[model samples]
Target: MDGTALLRWGRVCLDDLADRREEINALNVFPIADADTGTNLLATMRAAMAEVRTRGPVDALTTHDVAAAMARGATLGARGNSGIILSQVLRGIADAVRGGPLTALTLRDALRRASVLVRDALSEPIEGTILTVLDCAAASAASCRDASLADVALAAADGAAKALGDTPSQLGVLRAAGVVDAGARGLVVLLDALVSITLGEIPARPEYSPRASVAAQPVEDSGETGSAEPRFEVMYLLADTDADRIARLRARLAELGDSVVVVGDGEGRWSAHVHCADAGAAVEAGLAAGELSGIRIESFAQHGREMASGHPLAPVDSAGKLDGPADRGVLAVACGDDAAELFEEAGAVVLAGDDGVTAAELLAAIRAMPNREVLVLPNGALPAHDLVAVGVAARDAHRDVLLLPSASMVQGLAALAVHDRGRIAVDDAFAMSEAAATTRWGSLRAAGERALTMVGTCEVGDGLGLVGHEVVVIDHDVRAAGRTLLDRMLAFGGELVTLLMGAAARDGLAGELVAHIGESFPGVEVTVYSGGQHGDLVQIGVE
Candidate 1:
C-alpha cells in the first residue's frame, strides 16, 4: 500500500515476469496470432518501475504517489492491445487505492474494479482471456470474509492459476492452438509473485515448457503471412468530454474497426485504439470526437518482434554498450525554406517539405543520409504515416534512428539550437526534447470554417491563436490577437520570445511586437525571422 511495500511488490513481479516472459510469449493466440504478449507486459511493467524510481527518492514517496506514478507510466508506455488493456486496469486499481491503507477489503475492491475497467476498455469482450482470469481472482478474494491481506492474496493467486489452466476449454482458438491464453498465463505469474511477497516466501520458479510451439503469424494459401483481421492497428490519446460524444465515437469506431477500444477517464481524456483497413479514417473519427496525440499506426502484416512497429534495438557488445559506427547525424524534416536553413546550419540533413511530403520521400531522405545512426526530427509537420514509414525504412536498412516529436517550427528550432553533434545521440535527443519542452509554440491563423472547437465556435476568417494543436484564443484583429496571445504566454513567465514571421505578415509587425514586448514585459528578449510557412500569418514561441 505504501511506497516501500509497492516497491517490494514491483521487484517481485518484474523478476518473475522476466523469468517467465518467453513462456508467456509462446502461448499467444487469441485476438491475433502475435507472440508479443510477454514483451508488451514487460515493457509496461518496466515503464511503471521507471516512473516510481524517477519520482525523486523512493523512500519519500507515499502509497498514493507511487500508485499514481505507476498508472501514469503504464498508460503512456503501454504497447499493443493487451498492454493497453492492462494499463487501464492498473489505473483502475490505482484509483481504488488512492493513497489509502492497503487492506483485504481495499485489495478485493481494487481487483474487482480492475476487471471492470478492462472490460470497459474492450469493444467486444471474450470469455477466456486475461480478463476472465483477473475476474475469477477478484471473485475469490471478495468471497473471503474478514480474511487477512496475505490470505486473500494467496486465494487470489490460486484462483487466477486455476482460471489460466481452464482458458483452453473456454476459448476455441486457444484449444485449437493447444495452448493456454498467453495473457492469462502472465496474470497468473503476477498473482503468484504477489502471493509470495505477501507471505514472505521465496517464489517458485516457473518451468519454460510450452505444450505447443509455433510462430505468431498466420499464413495465406500463397505461403505468405496474412490475416483476415484488420490490416492496420491505430492508437492515440483523445482529449474531450461529452458522454454523448464519446458514445458517438464508440459507434463510429466500431463501424471502422472490429477491435475498437475507447476508454479512459470519462471526464475529458481517453485512450483510443482500433484495428482497421483505413488508419486515417480511424484517426479522423478521434479528431471529430476530440483532440488526439501520441498517435501510433502499425501494419498488421509486419508485426515485427514487438507486435507493434518497433525498430530492432541496436546491438550491445560484450561490454554491454550500444555498439555503433562513428558515422552518425541528424535527419530533420524542414517545413519551410528558413526552417531548412536553420536545420542545415546545425549539421542536419534537411528534407524540404515545401510541397506535400510523402512516405517515399521520407525513405529517400533517410537513404540520402551518410550516417549509420541518425536522429530523426519529422517535426510532426507532415502526415503520421510518412514519419512511421521513414522509421520502418530506417530499420530495414539497419540505421539507428531516434525520432523527436517536434510538432512546430519553434520546437524544431529549439531542439536544433540545443543539439550537440559530438554528443551521444540519445543524450542529445533528451537535451533537445527538454529544450523543445521549455519552449511553448503557437500560431496566428485565420479560420476557414465555422465549427464548434474545444475553445468554442469560430467564424470564417476569425483570427485563431493556436498552441500546440488546439485553438486557445479567437479574435478579429491579427496584430491585437498576436499581442493577446503573447500576453497569455508571457503570463507563464518566459525569458525570451521567438517569432517566425509568415509571408503574409507585415514588414514591421515583428519589430512592433519586439518593441511592445520590450515595454510590456521588460528584460524579455525578442527575436524574429521569416518562416515561409504555407499558412498562418505569424508563429510565436516562448522560452
Candidate 2:
C-alpha cells in the first residue's frame, strides 16, 4: 500500500469501527467487561489517522512515512488493554512494510509480523482473544504466500472470521455468555476493512449477541461494590528507558497484576498497561523504569455506568459549586471497606478501594470537594509522581491541595486523628504530617511462596511479619508471628497498639493479640479493627 492507500485503509477502518462500536461493546463480557472495546479501538484508530494527517497532504508523504506515523500515533494514543494490543498490530504492519509497496509477500509478512508483535506485547496471551484471531489471519496469509494482494487480504479476513466463529468454543467465558469474543470480532472488522480496501468487498459475518439466558447476567463480577478480580486498569506512556528496563518492568507488572502489555514503537518510546488491584503500585513500577506520561487509572466498578451513558461521571460538584469551596475537606485514600468507613466517620471524604488511586482520580476528587483547602491522606495509595501531578494540576485549577506524606493506612488514621479544620492550612498540614510521621507501622502476611527474607527463608503458608517493609519475623503459625511482631514493635515502648485485621485474618487473631498485649505489655492500650485489606493478614500501628 502507498501513502494514499495507507491513509485510506485507516480511514475506512475507523469509519467501520465507529459504525460497529456499540455492537462490539455489547459483546464485551470477558476481560472484566467494562464494555468499552469498541470505544478503545475507535480511539486508537483516530490517533493513527491524526498522526498521518499531520504529515501534510497524502502526496507529500511516502508509504514509509505514513506507516511509521500510524504506528507511532497508535502506540502513543492507545487506550485500554485492547487498544494497546491493536497498537501492536499497527506497529507490526509498519515494521514489515517499511516504505515498500504492498505486494502478496509484503502483505503476508505484515500479517505474520503483526501477530508476533501482538503476542510479544502481552504479558500473558490468552486463547479466544484478539490474539487468536490475528494469529489465524497471519497463518492464513502465510499459507497463501504466492497469492495476489487482494487474495491474501481475502484469505486473512476469512481466517479471522472463522476464528471469530470458533471463539465461543475455545473460550469458556464466551461459551457461557453465548457470544463470540468481543476483541476477536473487532479484529475481524479491521481485517474486513483491509479486504474492502484491497478487494472492494466487505465480508458478511453473523452478528454476535449475548444469549437471552446470559444477557441479564452481570458483565463483570468485581466492581465498586467489591470483586474477586483486579479492580483498576492502569496505562501510561513511558520513555527514556531501554529494553532491559522494559523487560524488568514487564516482570514487575506481571507480579502486581494481569493483562499486562508493554510495547514499544521500535523507538525508545513504549506504551505500558496493566489491570491491577493496586493502581498506585503499577504506576510506581513504570516510574521506577523510566519517565512516564499520560498515566490513566480506571476503576472497573466505576467505569460501566459512565461508559454505558457515553459520558464522564459527573463529579459531585453541585453543592461545591453553589456554596463555593468550603474551609476544608480531607481526602483519605483507604484500602478497605472498614478503613473507608473509619475515615468517613471522622468527617473526611474517602477514596476507598485497593484498586489504587491515580493523579487524575485525585484531581477529580479535589475538584469535587466542597472545601477550598483539601488535605489528601495518600495513605500509601498513590506514588510520589502522582502526588506531584495532582498537586500541580489542582493548583492550576485554583484549588489548594495538601498531600500529606502518610505512607500507610495506620499512618493515615493517625493523621486524621489530628486534622483540625479550624486551624490554619499550614498548621493543620504540620499537625497531620507530624502525627503520620510519629506513627510507627508494620504488617503480617501469610507467605504465598517460599522465599528468602530479612528474617530468614520462609515457606508457603508460613506467617511473615514486617516492620516498616522489612520482614523481621517468620513463624509457621501466623498467630505466633503476630505476637512476635508485636513484641518487637512494643519493645521500644508505645502507648497504644492498633491492629487492623485483613480479609482473611483468623477469627480470633485480633482478640488473641489484644489479650497477649494486655498480659505481656502491661498499661499499653490495644485497639483492633477489621480492615478487610488484601494480601496482609494484619497491619500493626504503634503510637
Candidate 3:
C-alpha cells in the first residue's frame, strides 16, 4: 500500500465531504428534528485526521495501521444514526483487511465485506443511505475481477455516484424532501476525493498577500491629518496549560481587532491570527497561554493601500465583523422559519439558516446590538457548539452576551415567550428563560433505522416522545403517542397543555391528538395549534 497515497486520499475525502455539509443537512425532511448527518461525518473525519497526524509518516503506516486508525476514529467520533452506519462500514473494511497486505484483491474483498456488514447491521436498510452506496461500490469492485487497485477504486466511485443519483427514486421521504440521498451523496464525494488524491490531482494553494495597505487609503487633503500608525497583522501558536484558560485569553483578543482567527485544541494547543491596531495586545494575549511560537507581525496599513491601487492582497483576517444590533439586538441560531420568527417577535435579530454564522458572527451580532448586553438562543442541539463558540468570541470581544441553552424547538419557543426586554441584566433573562423553557417538552419523529437509545427502543417511523433529554416513548399511532406523552407531561402536575402540530400532521392527526390530550389529561386544559409548517409532525406542550 502507498502510505502517502492513503493519507492524501483521506484528506481529499474530508475536503470533498466538508464542501457539501450544508446540502446534506438541508436534505433532512424533518428540518426541525434531527439533521446532523453531515456534521457528524465531518467530525468523524476530523478525528481520523488527528489520528493520521500522529502516524510516523506515510512510509511508516501499514495498511492495517491505517484501517485500524480510521475505525478507531470513527468509533469515537461518529454521531446520529447515519454516523453510526458510516462507522460500521469503516469497521467492516478494517476487519476484512485486518490480516492483509491490501493489494487490489484484498481491497476488493474488503469492500465486499464492508457492504455485507453494513446491510446486516441495519434492521431495515434504506435505499438512499451510505449503506446503499457502499453496497453498490462493493458490487462494482467485485464485477471487475482482474482490476488493479486504482481501477477498482475508480469503479467503486462510479458505482457510488450512480447509487447516490438513484436515492430520490428509491426513497419516498427523500423525494418529498426534495433532496438526493444526503448520506449517499456525502459518501460518494468522500470516495471521489480519495480517488483524486490516489491519482495525485491535488489542487494548488493560493499565494498569501498582506491586506493593511489596501485598507489604509488616505483621504484628500482636508485640513485634518490622519494618524500614520501602521496597523499590524500577527500570527502565532500558543501553548497553554489549560484549555479553559486559553478561552479567557481569546476573550481578551476580541477587543483589539477587525480580523481575528483564534482556533485552539481542547488539549492546550492554539493557533491564532489577527489584524489589529495594537499588535502588543495581541501578543500579550498569546503570552497568557504560557509560551508562544512562530510569531510574525506585518504592517497591514501599507498593504491595504497597495491593495486599493488594484493590487489584491490576501485577506488579513478571516473572522468578519460580529453580527448583532448596534444598540439593542437579538442573536439566535436556529433552524426553520417558525423558530426564527419566535425569537424575532421576542425582540431578537434572527440569523436565518445554519451555515455561515459562526461564533464570530454571534459576537459580531452581540457587539452590533445597542444594549450593553445581548441575549443568544441556540435553538437546536447541533448549534450548541456554535453558541459556545460565540460565547467564547463574546468573552474575547468583551461584549456582554448571554447564551440560553435551549436544546429543542419547544424549549426555544418557551424561552422566547418569557424573554423580558426591559431586563438589562443577563441573570434576569437567564432565570426567566430557564423557567419558561422548563414548562415545555420537545417531541420529534425519528428517521432512519430503529435503535435502542438511552431514551428507549425507537423505530425509524415511530413518533419519539421526549421529556427533556430522556426518550420516554416511541409509538406508531400519533394520537396514542401524543396521549402517552401528554400523560408524562401532566404527571408533573401541570395545569395547561398545548399541542402545536406540524403541517403534515394538521389534516389527519392534529385534531385526534387534541381530542386524546383533552381526554387523557383530565382537568388539564389542552390547546392544539398548528406548528405553522408543512410536515406530518406535532409539538405537544403541557404547562
Candidate 4:
C-alpha cells in the first residue's frame, strides 16, 4: 500500500481502539496494574497517524519515508510499557518492509520482525503479553505462505484473537483476574482492524458492553501475602547512545526497584519503567544514564487500592440510592480555582483535576450532584484506567453519566459553552461532545528538563507548543510558541478563539496574542481569562 493507504489504516486502527479503550483498560491486572495499556496504545497510534497526516497524503512520499516517520512518531509519543513495546513493534515492521513492495512475504517478514524487535527491546520478554499475540499472528501468516496480503492479514487477526484468549493460561495473574491480558487484547484489536482495512471494509463488530471482570478475592490470593509493594511507579524516556551505559542503568534500576523493565535500542533512545520506594532515586538513575524527559510518577499504593476495590475507591453519597426522579446536569473537572468557578457559573459542578485527580475525586463530584443524568467532562487528560474506573463507578451509583472525553481544559470550555440544559441528558451530551471534539486546542508550557520530544530535544524552561499531547514546536519565547501554536490551530479555520492563561503567565501575554489574532484572523472573536493553573503558561481553544 502507499502512504495514503497506510495513513488510512492507522486512523482506522486508532479509531477502533478508541471505541474500546475502556473495555481493554478494565482487563489490566498484570504488568503492575497501572491500568492504561489501551490508553497508551491509542496515544501512540494517534501520534503515528498525526505524523502521516503531517507528511500529507498527496506528497511524493516513499514507503520507506512513511514507515520511518510513523515508527519515529510512535517512539516519541509512546506512553506506558504497552506503548513502548508497541512502538518497537511498529518500528520493526517499518524496518522490514520500508525498502520493498508489501507482498505476502514482506507482510509475513514484517510481522516476524516486529515480534522479534519488541522482544529484544524488553529486558525479559513475557510470554503472555502483546508480544505473544504478535508472534502468534506472525506464525499464522507463515502457515499461509502463498496467500494474498488480505488473506494473510485475516489469518493474522484470527490468530491474534485466539492467542488473546489463551493469555490467561500463559499468565497466572490474568487467570486469577479471570480475564485475558489487557495488552494482548489491545494487540488483537489492532490486528483485527488491520484485517478490516486490508479487506477494504471497516467491519461491523458485534456490540459488546463491558462490565468489571475482576472477581473480588481471587483464589490465587488465598494464602499469598507480601510486604508493601513499591510505593511509586516511575517511568521516563531517556536518550543515550551507549548500549553499555543503558545496560548498567538497567542493572542499577533493578537494584533500586521491582518490576523493572527498561527497553530500547543502542540508537540513543530508551524508555524505563520501574516500581520503587524512592521515585527520586529512580529518576536520578535515569539522569545518570542520559538526558531524561516525559517523567511520570504515580502512586502504586493508590493504584492498588483502586484496583482492589474493584469499584470506585470512594463511593459517592452513602446508601448509594437516588431518592427520586432522575434529573440531568453537567460535571466538569477543572484545573484551577478560576477555571472551576467559570464552570460552576456555567452551571457545571466542578471537580478538582489535573495531575492530582483520582477516581475518587471524580466520583465525589458525581455523588455530590443530585442529578441522575450527568454529563462529565474530565477536563484534563488522565490515564485510561483511572478514567474508566471512574466511569464505571459513576454508572454503579445509578447515575447515567455520559463522559465527554475532554483531553484539555479548553475543550471542556468549548463543551460547556455549547451545553444546553434544556435538552435531555443524552441529547445534551451528544451536542456537547461534538463541540468539544470539533474544537482544536493547543497549550504552551515550559519544559521541565532536557528531554526528547516529537519536535526535538527541549531544554529546561524552553517553551513547548502542543496540539493535543503532541509537541508541535519548541521555542525560547512562550509568546512566539503561542503565536505559532495559534497559527497552526487556525490553519483549518476557526470563528472563535479562547485563551486561558495560567497563574504564571505574563500579564500582557494575552494582549499580545489577542492583537496577533485580530491581525491574522480578522473576524475571529477572542475571549481571554485567567485560568490560574500551574505548570502551563497558556491554553488555547478554537471553534
How many times do residue backbones clash in model 1? 0
Q: Candidate 1 clashing pairs?
A: none
131: Cα error in model 1, Å: 1.4
Worst 10 residues of 4 by lDDT: 218-227
Higher-lDDT candidate among 2 and 4? 2
| 1-543: candidate 3 lDDT, tens digit per residue | 555555666777678668767766655431111355577678767776677667667678776677667665664445444554555555555666667655678767878877775664443345565677888988888887787777777778888887876766766555555456556766776666656755554222122111334212322211111212326655565563465655566556556653344543223454555545666567656655545655666554534533443633223223332232233345666545665666677767776543444444555566666655566666553454345444533532233556777655556666676665444345346665775566767564543577887767776777777776667877876556766776777776777766666645536676666676567666767666544433326665655
Error (Å) of candidate 4 at residue 342 is: 46
Judging by lDDT against the true structure, name the best candidate: 2
The candidate that wins on TM-score is 2
lDDT of each prediction vs. the true structure? 0.74, 0.83, 0.58, 0.74
> What lDDT does model 3 reach?
0.58
TM-score of 1: 0.58
lDDT of 2 by residue, 1-543 (tens): 787897899999999999999999988877777789999999998998898888888898877788889889999999888888888788787887775867788888888898888888877777888889999999999998667899999999999999999988877777777888888888889989989999988889888778888887875432222224687888888888998999999989988888888999877789998887766567767866887788777877555533633543223344323223237789888888988898899888988758877656776787788765789888887667667646644642234678999989998989999986556666779999999999899999999999998768999999998998899999999899999999999999999888888989978888898999999999998888888888888989999
TM-score of each: 0.58, 0.60, 0.40, 0.53
Using lDDT as the yardstick, the better of models 2 and 3 is 2
Instruction: Put the candidates in TM-score order, highest first.
Output: 2, 1, 4, 3
Per residue, candidate 1 scores C-alpha lDDT tens digits across 1-543 of: 576887788788789789888888887765666678898888878887887878888888887677777777777667777777767666766777775856788788878988888887776677788889989999998898789988888888888878888887887777767778888888777777777878876445345345534444452222111223577777777664576777788788778776666776423467777777666567666666765677787776655533243545556567544566446788887767876887788778888886766665766677778776777777765666446534643553346667777777788888888877555567678898888788898888877889777889889878888887888888877677777888888888988789988877777878877887988899998888778777777878899
lDDT by residue for model 4 (142-172), tens: 8997788889988888888888877878877
Backbone clashes in candidate 2 total 2
TM-score of 2: 0.60
Model 4 off-target regions past 4 Å?
Answer: 56-58, 201-228, 265-267, 303-543
lDDT accuracy of residue 346 in candidate 3: 70
